[model samples]
Target: MPTSTSTSTSTSTSTALLRLRRQLLSTAYGNMDFRYQLLASLADRALAELDRHSSPEAEELADSHLRPEYIGITEGRALSEAGSLGIDTSGWEERRERIRSYTRGADAVTPDGTPADSAQRLWASLFDNYPSVAAALADLLTGLPPSWRMDLFQTNDLTQVPAEPRQQGDNGPETAPYSSTDWEDCAACMEANDLCRFHSGFLAGEQHLRGLLATLATDSIALEQLQDRNHEIGQRQARESAEKSPERETSQ
Candidate 1:
């Protein structure tokens, strides 16, 4: 049998790996937002300088400020961060370059007809061509804490989803029953298995993820898809509940 110390170390390694994946995804998402804001800031400076002086020197300075290399630098930093986590981003270079090219071309636009930032444009393209990636992004963002939520980029560009009431109980509101099970399992695992060191607050953290997912449902299609998934889960739960209480159903 494995010693308790070895089991704990194994659990710790597993937990670290899980957290690293989440961190990498969050960093990627946040980097796009950061890149957009950085570009916008440069543009704002260029505009202010342009207004102050119409000289060739001022124009050159403004143009230099918005150069693609600056964007590349920001993305490079993001890549480095991911690499540190053992994520092989070498293959991702092509996608990153495509994003840079699109942003440079000045064609991406938000749904409201405003200029879309690098991240927003990148997200839209990913949604169309690589929806699984986009879905993973949504899943990653949904779990971030409010204070930790990426704010450098504009979320307003996403289709605004009004906060909907979660399925409620007579007391006021309730989370899915599975959430409770997961929460309990997390706790029990941590207690019974020396190797399982999952966070005690993992359940609470899930709320943040859910809120982020709702925010990302930026279109009718996405919203419908999410709703459909939720409906399916609800149906499954209802069936399970019925099976477990067939006597109650018969009495009623």
Candidate 2:
């Protein structure tokens, strides 16, 4: 038998969870600007939650669970992780630093003392520098997994899967050294790989947050149970003390 208050709280939590899920799904398939906006929003939400439930244990859980993913998305660690998978992420750190400058307000002033690039301009710059970002995202829906791609992307025709990796000295122009198409393909694949890593980190953080929320919810219940047990022990001890006092009075 749940109280009205408890039911309301549960409904509120469910609503928040649904909203977070929708944000994550949109971020997954969104354009660069939309993705960046949602990521920033989600990060702020996580920080707000931490502030709302401030505790040493909560801070520790956030550091262990949420911080890594947040850093990965904001600081280009996802690209670095992809690099560890043998993907070439050359200049990724530099590009990430450029984005960071805008985020940190370092790029907020121009030479003429005018306000610098807006969010849209910054995103446009990123798009120009990394033309394959959108393509890589599209690849995720239309290239990687075959059966679900069509249903998800709503295309009657299947996208042609990329050919197998080329071996050195293979009898094809694609195997030629310094092929521009090869470079583009590599860039697209790396970007896609980075995105996948980012999504994995996001999911991991979400799981941690869910666990932390559950623990916070139970903390008051556990405290109430302990208090009740202690009260019962105190009452029992008082009864025993009174019973013994009567005997002492008779002896006296």
The lDDT per prediction is 0.47, 0.47
Global local distance difference test of model 1: 0.47
lDDT of model 2, residue 145: 62
lDDT measured at residue 220 in model 2 versus the true structure, 0 to 100: 90
Clash pairs, candidate 1, are: 142-209, 143-209, 159-218
Task: Please provide, for model 2 over 1-252, each residue's C-alpha lDDT reduced to its tens digit, 9 standing for 90 to 100.
Answer: 334433443345334433443455566556343345566567646644653454333334444544345534644567667878998778776866654542344234222222122333333434545457645655664665656746655664443543446433221111111222342323222222122233434546877989867875789986677679999999999999999998999999
Give TM per candidate.
0.18, 0.21
Per-residue lDDT of candidate 1, residues 163-203 (tens digit): 33432211111111122345332322222121122332453
Give the root-mean-square deviation of each candidate in angstroms: 25.2, 24.3
